[model samples]
Target: MVIILESLLGSMFEALLDYSEGFILRQEVGGVG
Candidate 1:
């Protein structure tokens, strides 16, 4: 119930963070190149 929801939210947040970091890195590389 609550535990499951918390785990799901945590994983989603982590994934979003990773995606954002990757996106930023790509944007910087594209801007430089």
Candidate 2:
């Protein structure tokens, strides 16, 4: 149970981090486009 929660939280945090990074990448790509 504890492990499951920890993994879930980790994935959620990773997704948020990826989202922010992707948003920045989109902006950079937009400028290049």
Candidate 3:
């Protein structure tokens, strides 16, 4: 149970990072174009 919760949290953190990176990239591209 603890291991499953840890994995879930890890995946959520990774997803948040991915979303932030993508958002930043989009903003940069929008600024350029």
Best by TM-score: 1
- Candidate 1, residue 17: Cα displacement in angstroms equals 0.2
Residue-level lDDT tens digits of model 2 in 1-33: 999999999999999999999889989899563
Give per-residue lDDT, candidate 3, residue 5.
100
| Candidate 3: tens digits of C-alpha lDDT, residues 1-33 | 999999999999999999999889989899563
Weakest lDDT window of 10 consecutive positions for candidate 2: 24-33
lDDT of 1: 0.93
User: Once superposed on the true structure, which residue ranges of model 3 sit more than 4 Å away at CA?
Assistant: 31-33
lDDT score for residue 22 of model 3? 88
Model 1 — TM-score against the truth?
Answer: 0.89
Candidate 1: tens digits of C-alpha lDDT, residues 1-33: 999999999999999999999889989899563
Which is better, 1 or 2, measured by lDDT?
A: 1
- Candidate 1, superposed: residue stretches over 4 Å from native: 31-33
